[model samples]
Target: MRNFKKYWSFVLLFFSAFSVFSQDVQFTQFYANPLYLSPSFTGGIVGYRVAANYRNQWTFVPGTFNTFSVSWDHNSPAFRSGFGVMAMRDQAGDGNLANTRMGVLYSYDIEPFPDWHLRPGLAFFLQQISIDFSKLIFSDQLTSTPMPPTSVTQPGKDAVWDIDVSSSILAYSDNMWLGVTWDHMLKPVATFYDDNSRLPHKITVHGGYRYITKGFLLSRIEESFTVAFNYRVQDIYRQLDLGLYFYSQPISFGVWWRGLPKNSVGRRVDALAFMVGYKWEQVSMGYSYDFTISRLGLASGGSHEISMIYEFRLTPKKRWKAIPCPTF
Candidate 1:
């Protein structure tokens, strides 16, 4: 029992201390998790919007990996701006390595060209991270076979805090949108140790286009086909997601491919995700199941994700012209 714990715990710490660990958690339904995708999406809605997301990954792995995020954004018609707040938490490994973040965003609306709308945004965030050193068993701690005679002092601190900056821009037209985001501008130190290792910079480029037809065979039903993709890079790690969605009235379905790597060590074709969504009035919800295509295989129990969103108006105010974008 002691041998099992020691070997596994050290493995967890070793990988986490290196750059192999992703500093930020990922979501399968990128369109559903708007704020986490880009700061410019903060208030980029017809009205006030609230969204929540949850993901569970690698059930077959020794430890658990879970991530959750919630955010709120309000598009002020009078100011023609977007304001939002987001909070997220990710916990992984048996030692319970965890990262939690909170952020506030503000975006201003601009029109660089005639029919295109540009939204530029800025965000300030604080992060807190922790790892359980008591669970880790080092070489010095193991004198003989079973364990050490005396208790080993904890290796790392209980928790560490840091502040960071991020920015994003969204450019959109009637049926198309393009967005880019940059994170970890300050490259804050992430480890519990006294060393100088810092967080790597991350950039994401995402866009989508929708082809709409007013009515289907049924007069009340509307039909549309949409294609979207996201390309993200953090240090040497890169990921790509391409998806196609078909919308018929209140229901929508989509398929996405995650990974599509760039010859990187840790980045490989990871999963294929199937998603379904429904919307009624101001409320919407989405669910996705990821089929692991990586070396982990189906033994990982794949992954599951769900998102909920609500958009509404608080008071009757003069509305600004809205840019057309996908609801999910």
Candidate 2:
């Protein structure tokens, strides 16, 4: 057990050298947290919404990764606008390296044709990255009993703050939708040290199509199948998630394969995710498990995620065209 702790500590210390090349926290149930997925998805529904998400990655490993997020959004049909606010925090490893962000976003809805809608969105965020040097074990300290403090020089400040911007556009009809997002548009500086290391811009292309096999009494979606894909590129890293969803009334199930199959040079295959969800009246909830297939293998205990959303109307009698995206 002591050797295990020492092993992870050393691994964390090694990765800390490349801290500037950070990646965003990921969730298997992308649409479950609409605002996080894309600002254009803000207020995509007929009413206001509140959502929360939590993810724990590599549970078998000590202090591997934990992330949490919450968001609120409102759709104003009269104004053809969507407004939202979101907050997220991610913590990694025993060193307590963490990132936090709070942001506000807005989207304008335009109806170009009878059943087609286009939306453009913008978001602004305040981001902070911090690390606790006290928790980290240095190489010299690991070799002895009653380990002495690390000889490494702590940074003058423990945290760095920056401002960031993101933009997105989405187009949708009654059964299909496509969207694109560019994040870190301002190329925010993210390093704790004086060296100018800016957060790299990330591009995402995401879309899906829904096939309704059966309808409810009110002509709403009942039994259906959805096919979706999300592709993302940041710096030199690339990932793709292709998934299928099946829904029948209150129950939904999804299966996803994450990673590029063609890339054999590195860890091309990440995980296979399985998800289950339930919707009751105004509330919806989802849970997913990632079966790690990378070199980390099953010993990593994969990952677990849970999400919840509640929707309500600010006014009693307002209607809007719903974006044709999967709810979970």
Candidate 3:
């Protein structure tokens, strides 16, 4: 048992050191949200939209992390294309990182029948990642006995460039829709160590279906049910998440279960997420909390997420009926 503890401790130290150079950010509960990480999700809505999100993780753990992001997306009716931009900043312990991305999406609509429309889109993205290494605290064990205390002065900073190409196919009717998207095609590296120790890229595939059932036992209370699932695969690990959402016109609630990766040796971990949101006119607010089912449950408190979204429609006035919208 002593040897086992030492082995695991070494493993954690190695991963923690490597994490200083990795560009990939970790999230606790992913299925409750989608647009937080993927730039290709731009122009998915009907009109011009803006979204902002903030997350606080592991409240029980000392020196936990916080992440904040803001994004704007707009689609052109005349050009049948869309554009979006997003920026994010993450801070954990003493290390701070920032990312900015710009995306352009071109979509083509296919009319397979009278009532159904299929839209396939291709998007190009450019991202810049910057790291501030001065804040990081290296392990004291790395130093010799009677070593002097370390100071934050004379820290290192590094930056990297990454490009991503993604594609999505969306099938929609009046009440039902399905979509599939692929991200992180370039597999850009952002390690502080040797260039060969590259971070692995991830691929995710997801789809969801919604069903509306009206008036069984309660009057004026209608139920909208949805089932969503996603699979994420990478070189180090993979995860599968499935959940159900029950919603009315003004409020929504959801519960999810996440399956552990096959190679994970730790106690199986699951998440119970509860989400509530309200829609008012063209604006919406959402909040979710997740509780873990692993041994760390006592040590790592919980995760919290909050988001705000707004949408605006741009349409031609009656007097502009004769004028055609400009194309880009």
Predictions in order: lDDT: 0.80, 0.85, 0.58
Q: Rank the candidate models, highest TM-score first.
A: 2, 1, 3
The best candidate by TM-score is 2
lDDT of 2 by residue, 1-328 (tens): 5566656655555467355345677789989988888999988877899999999999999878899999999998778899999999989888788889999999999989988999999999999888888787677677779997655556798888899999999999888999999999988766667777788898989999998899842346778899999998877678899999998889999999998647533577899999999987788899999999998998999999999999995553644578888855
RMSD of each: 3.9, 3.9, 7.1
The candidate that achieves the highest lDDT relative to the unseen native structure: 2
Ranking by lDDT: 2, 1, 3
Please write out the lDDT profile of model 1 over residues 282-311, one tens digit for every residue. Answer: 788999999999887888998889999999
What's model 2's TM-score? Answer: 0.92
Superposed Cα deviation of residue 289, candidate 2 (Å): 0.1
lDDT of 3 by residue, 163-277 (tens): 8676667665544555666656666554444446554666666666666676432222255777776666666566667777776766777777767666753344566666777
